[model samples]
Target: MSTSPLPRPSDLIARRRAEVAALLATDAAQAALAIHGTPLLLLDTARVEQQFRRLRDALPFVRFHYAVKALDHPAALAVLDRAGCGFDVATSEELALLVDGSVDTARIIHTHPIKKPAEIEHALAVGVRTFVVDNDAELAKFSRAPRDVRLLVRLAYRNPHAKSDLSSKFGVGFHEAERLVREARRRGIRVGGFSFHVGSQLDDPDRFVHAVDETIAFMSRLERQLSVRFDTLDIGGGFPVGYDRDVAGIEDIASGIRPSLERVRGRYTILAEPGRILVAEAATLVTSVMGIAERADGRWYYLDDGVYGAYSNVVAEDVHPLVFAVTELDGDAEQATHRWATLAGPTCDSADVIAREMLLPDLRVGDPLASPAMGAYTAVTSTRFNGRPLTSIAVLSQAPATGEVAIPAATSGVGGPQPQTVP
Candidate 1:
């Protein structure tokens, strides 16, 4: 139950606008114009710090490499850098971003399972020593290079409890992983470690511990057979963040890894690629209702942002977004639900639906809807389908005195500079 009474829809809209107005008051008029009257993502940098501190306190020995692919905005990247975390990058473009952002090149690892030779050469030239490879072909490409670098072999396995429900199509098998490791040794390259990622949004807390245990066993066997030992083990990113009530907490998931950590016997280092869990709950996407229609059988509410924007995942995965409707009320009373709604987007495609059979109160046009857990995949995976523009973006830092969010200046534009925003 909501301890604070919910306001009516008009009051809620008024409050939200007032909040945005005050937050944007200090920002330039251009910033306001760029972000005005559209769906926007708000990121809470403070929450990310809190999560980082929790990890530092719990697992001080391990390093958390923030996956840039999750949400690579410079403002968000600044938050992680200030929090004392490194980066896990897949492409040369991400590496260039880090370099331009003044992030240490040595701290960023080129960890894509498959990397182009030019990318590898650029990474080595730029002082990125660590790279991950999954097969002998990728290893062979790197082995012939003029520069020697630290190589990590990636392995694949099944995790039956992934929330995102991804199966193994990425990593190499155990034997293949061993072959890559041995070949690296034969080529005089530094056999740095092993890595694996159990799918994303995994609810099972023991999944990491279980994979770690198996990995430890595999490493031990390989060491005894090949007479080689690796010093780093990257347990790839699959950390879970709260989406709905059913999503598990970080503490609940990390609690299981302690037992496995105690059993691991090596001078090896442990690391993780955490993307979604760090940014998912810390950000929210705000979109406005553009139109509403009530049919004899159902009700449909259309939003300005659709599958090409905030609801891109719905088009990609056929999953509905969790939407929260806000409203204002009189006499200190909370708003009550009156009807159900099926939310659609402002697109001509028949597949542009956001949510079907969603329950909502009697809502109206121009009312704002918030979808939490949207920070990870929404913005990065957006498209230009139907020539729709990308949503505006903003960052929030906590005010120590007020304990409320203070929205800082953001890089915002519409359908112009950013290709993702061209409509």
Candidate 2:
């Protein structure tokens, strides 16, 4: 339960704005942004460690596996690895990052539900025996696998409201999951447990708890019906972070989950594959307005980054990252007048636009725009669209008092150009 009156969404953004401003105020941040030019990502490994520690403290019973697909910045990985968090890899390349980084392979879990036979073999050869599969064809790949191999059946719990409803692409329903489990047993494969992603950036802690309850209940039912047991329960990552606004607090989400886990604590191994939460706050995207134009709609400021690049989260996830002018961060925000302007990305494709009707101060050409909470999908899912080079990342130093490095508030216009506003 919330103890104090929860801070307003503006308060949350103001807090992040201060953090981002402090980081930008530092000479290091300035130098990096200048040297790297517009459209740069400042990744602080320290923040990654911080977020992981937060998760650990909130849900101490759950083993966290940093989903490598989130940021995958070697700097971020190094921090997480040092913090003793495991890795959850979905692709051969992601697994390679861990192996090449000399991470203990035992600490890795390959959680992609569908994969080529070669990919599975590659992971297995590297000592990653734990994998997630949702279908019979995926299970058949392990018919000749060693007894050391363990598979986690991926279950689907559709959450249409989630930013990314992973269930549509992966996971088996209850009946399909049971069949997959039995099939694994028939193939003489060791079934580890069940796993499900409660959708990306999910806000409902109750939904998270519901998914856990449902999965646990299903596991119990399966154990009784098939006379087999599961050794793990992978609650795939959907832990909400303050993006645009504070979603659900970590403790709030944990409160909903802990009771369920305590009842089954010693009965099974519990795990989580956290992607966005771990690294989302660890990085911020700093872009510069390359050109300002008076478009048919209104004033448009085109930045060096676009949806195909760092702002890919905006286009792909349908989530907007706050955009702020340097004047705002410098504590010289012009409040007397504010105009709603369009922030467009630098791609030839018109769809590359980042945000629309974003309220802002009178921004001039070459003004720096910072987007927080960009450490996650922004970089990993970005592409080299329009021949623009991928954004460069600068690793920041540990400065706990500087400010939190969460995602830029999703509300671009919520507190536009205010000293308390963050991107």
Candidate 3:
């Protein structure tokens, strides 16, 4: 039997544009725009809860720790915490975000392979027990900790194709992992099973299954040779999100590795660190054209927000988020003429260009544009360059009536007033 063809790049772009358009038309989007104006992010905690549920349903047996670095907004953390999602933090500051939110320390894990001694002490002080270490130096820091502290040996599986190959900076290879595990044993550190990240934003499902299979095999071999038992396996987060193109979903990746995990289901505690997938689609960015210029190459539209702001994911993760003019979503795009133009950010730096050769409708200086999937690594990685203020984020919730939107408050990072309704 013949199967349906996959979506082309143009089709994916159109779909994403339509999706962003729908978000812009929502009551919450309108309310945020009315109150906060342009260069704003509408964060839907309901969407965060939905994405978390999707990840949970996809991998029912695996305990998911929402990687705090993705988007550390208190609203996002509160939603995930309420949903009973654990947190994976890399630094004391991230842990503090959880702690300040009153998240139970039992649900937190320190995943930074290398940490300052003070950071380790802070985590331990807060009742955090599980930690990850990739080298002898890191393991040695935990040597003086209480006997109940357990560490996961980080193993590296390189995939250069991923947006970010985390293995390069923080994981151990086969021989190196063997050495670390043996070294940890010598120091009397409890090496809880193993943990590895295939890579960040990895699209290959087979890579995840391969990492799981390989790690399980290595764990078994070490258990036999070293006579040490490992009780946990953290398959680090790399689940891909379709930014400007179609990619594998959590269910697809979960299905690929579920069989292998099922083989050792009860024998080991399976854990996953999902950062991007859980929060990326939960936010939408709205920016307006601050200025328009006719450069030598073509027409250039300068938006108030750029790579230095919400679009930092473009420069850092190499993922291009689809940009749509508000007209495109309002059903007038087809009637308007389009041209290939460069979209730039409001910054003196040349590197602040958001999208090169973007096909957009003729937009005025004040026309609005929206980009979806702006939740992960966008605001968190944004910089206050050119003396510009960070773009404000408006936390959104649903009204009693279907399809209505409500803004609970302008969030903290934007330096806005405390919780107040945006009618």
Candidate 2 per-residue lDDT, tens place, 222-270, comes to 9999999889999999987787877887778888899999888899989
Q: How much does each candidate deviate from the true structure in C-alpha RMSD?
A: 6.1, 7.7, 4.5
Q: List the candidates' TM-scores in order.
A: 0.84, 0.91, 0.95
lDDT per residue as tens, model 3, 1-423 = 112222333767777767777777777678778888989998988989999999889889999999999999888888899899999999999998888889999999989999999999999999999999888889889888999998998999989889999888998887888998888888887888789989989978899999999999999998999888889999999999988878998889989999999888798999999999988998989899999988788889999999999899999999798888886676666566778888999999999989997777788989998888999999899988888888788988765465555576665352233555555
Best by lDDT: 3
- lDDT per model vs. reference: 0.70, 0.81, 0.87
TM-score of structure candidate 2: 0.91
**What is the Å distance of residue 375 in model 2 from its true position?**
0.8
Candidate 1 segments exceeding 4 Å error: 1-35, 145-148, 164-167, 263-266, 317-320, 328-337, 398-423
When summed lDDT is taken over every stretch of 10 residues in candidate 2, the lowest stretch is: 412-421
Q: With candidate 2 superimposed using the best TM-score fit, by how many Å does residue 199's alpha carbon deviate from the native?
A: 0.4
Deviation from native of the Cα of residue 300 in model 2, angstroms: 0.6
Runs in model 3 lying further than 4 Å from the true structure? 1-11, 399-405, 412-417
Worst 10 residues of 3 by lDDT: 1-10
Ranking by TM-score: 3, 2, 1
Which of candidates 1 and 3 is the stronger one according to lDDT?
Answer: 3
Distance from true location, Cα of 268 in model 3, Å = 0.7
Question: Which segments of model 2 are wrong by more than 4 Å?
Answer: 1-9, 334-336, 399-423
